[model samples]
Target: MNLSPKLLEVFTTALAVPADQITADLDYQGIPEWDSMSHMILIAELESSYAITIETDDLLEMTSVTNVVDRLKKYGIEA
Candidate 1:
């Protein structure tokens, strides 16, 4: 649970996945928990978590854990 609590909650809710399945190594593909609709849900979840917003470019670029973290940082979010 190294991720921000809000982020973690959103990931869990959007992907319908278990805590054990979540990690920095996890990506948006090759996993039953990830899909197109789930991706959109993840976007919304992330926006809500940071209490800010993301752009279409960032949203489409969110392919892995690192991407998510980096984008949050770009938004001046510490988590």
Candidate 2:
């Protein structure tokens, strides 16, 4: 699957948000749906989808959709 679509799925499913509402500018804690619980869900979904482990610091740094894409790239994922 394409990275963007997969990311949308993760965000949509984890945060229970509409796919159309997901954008690169979408940020963690920016919405009620993206609370601490949903944040971990998003992290797990991303890790499982990318088949890569993320550092704790990276997890903490994942503040936005664009940030996720950039961090995944650091792991050699073509986001």
Per-candidate Cα lDDT values, in order, are: 0.81, 0.84
Give, for candidate 1, the lowest lDDT window spanning 10 residues.
1-10
**lDDT by residue for model 1 over 1-79, one digit each (tens)?**
3887767777889889987777887889858878889988998888886777898888888888777887888899765
TM-score of 1: 0.87
Compare the candidates by TM-score and give the number of the best one. Answer: 2
Candidate 2 residue-wise lDDT, 1-79, digit = tens: 2346677787799889988778878899898998999999999998898788999989998988888888888898766
Model 1 clash count equals 0
The residue pairs that clash in candidate 1, if any, are none
Measured over all alpha carbons after superposition, the RMSD of each candidate to the real structure, in angstroms, is: 1.4, 2.3
